[model samples]
Target: MNKTVFITGASSGIGRAAAQLFLQQGWNVAATMRTPDKEKVLTGANLKLLQLDVTDSNSIEAAIREAIVHFGQIDVLINNAGYGSVGIFEAFTPEQIHRQFDTNVFGLMNVTAQMLPHFRKNKRGTIINVASIGGKVTFPLYSLYHSSKWAVEGFSESLHYELRNLGIKVKIVEPGVIKTDFYSRSQDMINDENLEEYQHYLKTVFNNTQSSGTNGESPEVVAKAIYKAATDGSKKLRYPVGSPANWLLPLRKLLPESWFFAIVRSNVEKGL
Candidate 1:
């Protein structure tokens, strides 16, 4: 029997790419997003476009139930609905901080919680959380974004122990800077007129980040890594995809904390 994969944030980028790739590989795909009606692509006999906002438990539950009704079972769950809120940490308003964590960290937990009962009953499933290289290594102006992803990394690692005993696997995809709308429309900027102290430093770091993004891997590369994680049939917890992630994850592990910070500062912050 063909397996089924339910993906969040399927409107574009890694989620959309994963949906298409899974469908091509003969799996049923539940391509979900906030606005499914606006999605013009990834339609076929095996694909079910769904409206799901991870921040809304009702929407998450409804989408998962509808997907189960349509596909009979969900073999994999991909948590890919998140955005980067970048800027000076002190400039971030309470609302912005809450929104960032609500969508990235808490929202991911909500979806995972909703899927657990179904997955436990089935005795076999996979949860692939799309984190970033920033999850493991921090950058200058992405304090909120990195916090959320770090939370995800820690959550996935600990959750793996509990879920594995139930025959379910939890995986984290740490992608490097992928060439996606995330660098454009999907990113939120923090602004505070009173907090103009860090303007020059912020601009330099932001410019450097944007320039690096132009040379990063495509979303499809991360999609392929996600697919491998889902179907690899092993207990692997972390799969770092893309160039910088693959290279830098090891560097972070091997190097001292201060050294790693220095390297990041030099490459991304200094002379920027």
Candidate 2:
């Protein structure tokens, strides 16, 4: 029997790409999104489109239950439903901060919690968390986004130790700058005109960040990495994908704190 992978945020980008690739590779796909009705791309006998709001526990439960019912078992769970909240940290309202953590951190934990019992029973499974290279490093104007991803990185690392004993694996896919809706449709930019001091810095950094995203690799690159993590059958934890991430992650580790911070600041402050 072929394995089934349940993916969140499957309407587009990395999630959609992963779903398509898995189906093409002869695996069952439970492609989930907030508005499944609007999705027209993923369709096949082996694909099941379901509605899932990662921030909502009821929705998470319903989606997981439905997926298991349809596919009999889920061999992999991809926690990919998240958006970026960018801009001045002080400009962000409490609600924005809460929502950022809600979707990116708490929501991911909730989904993983729901899958644990099932995976434990089966004694074999893979949990792939779609994090960002930002999780390991930082960029300007993305404090909130970076913090949330950092939380994911820490959480996944700690969880891996416990899950390994249960015959379940935890994998983190960190993509540097994949050309995806994350830079637009899914990005939340916080701005305050009253904060005149940050305007110049924000503009310079935001422009640099946007340029990187525009020139980034396709989401398919990250999807391939996700596929490898799921099927590699190794205890490997972190799979960094895309161009700069392949270099930056190692560079960050090799360089001193001052050196790395200076490099990041210089890159984002090019126009300043």
Candidate 3:
């Protein structure tokens, strides 16, 4: 590939899939992960592994420089690093929320800030932000995670408007639940052992996430969407990946607030 792409969280999940896709298409990929050595799957001449933690500013700066040095200049940047911490709102601590935002929201800002000089100098760049349908709507027990995604949505959209006159482009890929380790690795907002206050809601959210996760779409579905949004040269746009997101987003908007929240409450309250 003639273009070089910088992808965060390139070790796993959607980030890994997108990186692999880009590399397979002949693009140079600077894949950074918190534990780059553990990324046994993403190895090749076109790939450069870098150790990066979104929470670490030094790591972000170093990775940006390394990516520019390795690839000449960053044609595209995929902000894909983040984790989900789902649980009842009342059960979440301030620290937990900070950790979530640091990685998902501010971490992304830091990376973008560091890469601006490169993009500005070239006057050409594409930024693809991996947001979620939760960015537009909410689900039970996912307040913190969804909130972060909403921030991503707002930030990316605003940047799209701001940077459009420039040579930069911004797009958001809003995927519905996907079959990723996110569910398995997701932190329990309230641990089952010690968290007894919101037992009912916790059970509801856990059961719902598990049930929905099973039938969710594949990572490739999202990979294809990300590829299009990044390379298509389209202006700021939101591509809702997966049938559920495409269908649900319109429905959620058409429905009244009470109806939507009631439906969410009903579905979540079930099998609790």
Candidate 4:
């Protein structure tokens, strides 16, 4: 029997791309999103669309249960349901901070928790967490987003140690700048009109950030990386995708703290 992969945030971007690729590669796909009814892209005999709001435990439980019933077993779980919140850190309200963590960090944890028992029972499974190069490197106007992804990176790395001996693998897929709805539809920009002091700085950094997305690789690139992590059958943990990530990640590690920060400032805070 073919293996099955359950993906969250499958309505678009990397999640949708991965779902399509896995199906084409002869695997069953449980494509999940907050509004499954709005999705018209993914459809086939081996595809099951599920409604899942990662922040909601009931929704997560229901989606997992439905996926298992439909596919019999889930060989891989992709925690791809997340969004980015950007802007001045000082302007971020308590709710925004909580929202960022709730979706990007807590939500991912919740889904993984729901799947652990099932994965444990099977004794063989892969958990792929969709993180970002930002998890390791930082950029302007994305403090909240960076913190959430950093949590994911740390969480996935630590979880891998415990799961390795259990025949369950934990992998983190870190993409650089993928051309996706994350730049627009999936991004939350924190704006405060009263905080005019950082207006020029914010505009400069935001424009620079947007330009990176404009030149970003297609979501398919990250999807291919995700596929490799799922099927490679190795204990490898981090898979950084996209051209920028290839160089950026290593550079961040090699360069000193001040040097790396300077480089980031030069790029994103050029005009400021």
List the RMSD of every prediction in angstroms: 1.0, 0.6, 1.7, 0.8
Q: Least lDDT summed over 10 consecutive residues: which range in candidate 2?
A: 203-212
**Residue lDDT tens for model 4, 7-118:** 9999999999999999999999999999999998898899999999999999999999999998899999999989999999999899989999999999999999999999
Model 2: per-residue lDDT, tens digit, 1-272? Answer: 98999999999999999999999999999999999999989988999999999998999999999999999999999999999999999999999999999999999999999999999999999999999999999988888999999999999999999989999999999998989999998999889989999999988889988988899999999999999999998899999999899999999999999999999888989979
Query: Considering only N, C-alpha and C atoms within 3 Å, which residue pairs clash in candidate 1?
Result: none
How do the residues 2-32 of candidate 3 rate in per-residue lDDT, one tens digit apiece? 8998999988889999999998888999999
Q: What is the C-alpha lDDT of each candidate?
A: 0.93, 0.95, 0.86, 0.94
Cα deviation of 255, candidate 1, in Å: 1.3
TM-score on alpha carbons, each prediction: 0.98, 0.99, 0.95, 0.98
Candidate 3 vs candidate 4: the lDDT winner is 4
What does the lDDT come to for candidate 4?
0.94
Error of 4 at 26 (Å): 0.8
Give one clash count per candidate, in the order shown. Answer: 0, 0, 2, 0
Where does candidate 3 clash, by residue pair?
1-26, 1-27
By TM-score: ranked, best first: 2, 4, 1, 3
Cα lDDT over the full model 1: 0.93
Model 4 C-alpha RMSD vs. true structure (Å) is: 0.8
Candidate 1: list runs displaced more than 4 Å. Answer: none
